[model samples]
Target: MEFNLTWILLGLPVAFVLGWLASRWDLRQVRADNRQAPKAYFKGLNFLLNEQQDKAIDAFIEAVQNDPDTSELHFALGNLFRRRGEYNRAVRVHEHLLSRGDLSRSDRDRAQHALAHDFLKAGLLDRAEDALRRLEGTAFEAEARLALLAIYERSRDWGQAAAIAGKMQQAGQGDFSTRLAHYLCEDAQTRMAQGQFDAARKLLEQALATAPQAPRPLLELAQLQQRCAQPAQALDTLENLARQAPASLPLAATLLVDVAQATGQQARVQGLLETQYRQAPSLDLLQALVALDQHIGVPDAPGRARLVQHLDHEPSLVAAAQWLQGETLAEEQYHPAVQKALDHAAKPLTRYRCAACGFEARQHFWHCPGCQSWDSYPARRVEEL
Candidate 1:
């Protein structure tokens, strides 16, 4: 074949031009893909900022499909799913991230934490507990422990709660002494209900040793002692409570009066209560004092005088009603109706109320039944507060 130099020279430039055009087409395609991904991502972000979560979720799904390798996009999608109550989808996303062997250690922990949260939100307590347990040695240990504590508390698993609280206390998270004591007291209550008196006593004793200054253990132990027919020991426990936790005396005043009468320690109790009343004249303590005076054969007139004295200090309607119940009114027939109305009005004022949740109860509670908050109710009654 004869060589054509002119044709060969023309064909070389044509081939070069074709190659350049192909390269330009590939670059433009890549730029378009990149632009589409960001556009979807920004659309999602705009939706989120506008609080349009459903629309944001759709946009994020589009962005994730366009950029499947982006871990942060996966996380955002998972969080959005969780927020929208799509817990199963959130679990799937986090589990996919966790399955990626190329994920960093920190990212794996984060994925695990997110998965635990998904389980929690889904009300899958067992799965949530397992996932949280796996985070024990991670930087999320403290947070995981706290969540576990809440779970245990909600489940009424006091032993587990105490163990986690002990760990958190050891880590210097905060002072969990009172919380630990409460757990012990709760456990003791369960044991007592099961007719395990000895075990219950031991648990309460341990609780007192754990937090000597905590009022609950002392009060619970005194009740246990009285139940065992050891009123003298119960009186001693209540005396210790009065000394260690004077602010909690009103809650224990009725118990004190009972134990004192049982143990023949009315004089001692009367003096202690008088001293406390001088410091903080609570209605409960005053009522106890009156009951004690009646028990010890004090004059009725003098005993009724105490309620009038309390009215001088607190301007309490409850006190006025109590005082009038024992009075000789000018119109004796009308007195009964007036006293009945006064008592009816003052009944609610005698109820104890939770300071945290405003839950009212006829009796004082160491823990709020409504909010599950410990020590949320003040010792004082509604009228006193």
Candidate 2:
């Protein structure tokens, strides 16, 4: 019995010692693993700081392998891949992170956003939209919504764009009234094309109510009214536009003449044109005056004289060309060639210039074709501007 008790006591000490040694070995292994992860991470950071992207990626891969659970390392590697245009790899890393069970809420949201951006950059708009839509009610909601807005705009989905803009407006992101008005105007244009004039008119009216100061809806509404043979209403709409946004009157100047002739408001229209022309001698406004004078019984000599008078105020080749068209040239045989050259030279100057990008187009655009900015084209022509 004594011998058995002695063996038991010795076995207890030996077992405890073995357990202690095993624990120590495990602790050492864990420490080594932890140290290796940080070392690899630092090495990657050093490579990144030195702008050695290739080496940085290698080191980051090592770090990720060492500590696969590190969400931050995964995020960094994904972002690096995306920056290098390795969208496939970036997408994989971000998707893997998203699949991790241990990822925090914020980290998951971040990974989701990154993945969406990857898809967007990859031109997988459908996938990107789906990813972004999933981000609603998260911290990335605002950014996701903005991206969705851009997507809808690019696709020309006016109804969806308007709904998103409405939500953004309600959320107080910024004043989306003007943007909303544009969507309505776009919808109205489509309706007009589909032969739905009353619907178009109603939409335009709503647009005007949404943003009274916006010029596009008013201009489009006037055009719709004229197209439906509601010339008086069209004239009244344009008159309001002249009162509210005098600068944009030049855009509708030719239309103004037609509406005036149709509605028998020639005197009132002529006065408005002359007053506006005096305030701003745009070539377009001058053209409106010329048309109105011709329609009202003003003599051709006086009508041509108006262009000559404008030439003194602005050094406009366009005006000079117009004045020459009616003048009696001494070399009448060569007048055609000279006038043609002058008209050709004045054509580019008459184009509208984008205020944001300096892109010139023959037709004025509410939204710039070059930069996709709204209201980028000023009311004046390149020569006047």
Candidate 3:
């Protein structure tokens, strides 16, 4: 066929015009679809802002159905379901996302994390543990490990908790030495209850080695030694505690007094407690000092004098009550009732309070029952605080 320049020129413009029209049609269709998806999404957002979760869920479901391939929508819908306590639906949505081969690596990790959260909120601990463990080398590793630690702690699996804590420490998540020591202490307590004294002692020693600055291990070790009829060893442990962690001496005060009496070292312990009291006065230390003095043949007058001295330093009601208990009041007939009232008023001051959750207990707790925080209770009593 012979080439026709005129026809060729005409055909080029016609093809161009058709191509432009087709492109415009596709663009308009895409805009319409985008607009429809956002309209439902905005409606969901409005419902969520109004605190109408049910309506928000319905709107989000409609949006997800309209845009099934949208990863963001799937994530939003799954989070809403989980928040509404609809774990099964949330699991299905995240599982559907995970099942897609087209999902990016980051989105896949995100979906896995969401699924783990769903299982955790549903109280399916075993399922949650498995799901979290799969996230081990991902960006969510630290968070997953923390969740696993909590699960292990809730189950009273101290060994698993220690393992997770050790991993977190190695990852530079935070200094978990104190937490690890607490886990060891918990395990040792269980061992002690089972009459496994040797195992308990070894665990406590390991805890001391793990966190030398942490007072719990030292205190627990001293108690364990005393229980094992090794008061001399217990006294040595408390002396090391006084030297290394003097700030924690108040918490170990009663134990110190008991050990000192048991080992016939009351005079030496009395001097140590007096020195600690001079540096940082605490009601517990004062009580320990008085007990020690009384054991070493000190008169009631001098022992009561220590409480008066404490009052001069810290205006403590607990100290005043202790002082009055030994005083000979002029109205001897009313002394008993007056002393009873003072003791009752000072009782709460002697209790230990959790720093994290304001939980008051008669004894110090390494782990707070109210907030599940480790080492949350300060060494001092409520009065000292």
Candidate achieving the largest TM-score: 1
For model 2, how big is the CA root-mean-square deviation?
A: 3.4
Query: Model 2 segments beyond 4 Å from truth?
Result: 1-35, 328-334
What does candidate 3's lDDT look like per residue over 1-385, in tens digits?
A: 9888999999999999999999999999999988999999999999999999999999989998889999998998999999989999999999999999999999999999999999999999999999999999999999999999999998989989988988898889999998888888999999999999999989998998898898889889999999889999988888899888999899888888988989898888888899998899888899899888888888888888888888777998888877887778898999899989989999999899998889999988887888898878888989888
Q: Report lDDT per candidate.
A: 0.93, 0.91, 0.91
* Tens-place lDDT digits, model 2, residues 1-385: 3457878888999999999999999999999999999999999999999999889999999999999989999989998899899999999999999998988999999999999999998888899999999999999999999999988888889888888888888899999999899989988989999999999989999999999999889899999989989999898888899888999999999999999989999998888889888887888889888888899988898789888888878888998898888877888999999999999999899899899898899998887878778888998889987
Model 1 clash pairs? none
lDDT of 1 by residue, 1-385 (tens): 9898999999999999999999999999999989999999999999999999999999989998988888888899999999999999999999999999889999999999999999999999999999999998999999999899988998999989999999999999999999999999999999999999999999999999999989999999999999999999998888899899999988889988998889899999999899999999999999999999999998987778898888878899998998888889888999989998999999999999998899999988877889888899889999988
Pairs with backbone N, CA or C atoms under 3 Å apart (clashes), candidate 2:
none
Winner on TM-score between 2 and 3 is 2
lDDT of 3 at 321: 78
TM match of model 2 to true structure: 0.88
CA shift at 351, candidate 3, in angstroms? 1.7
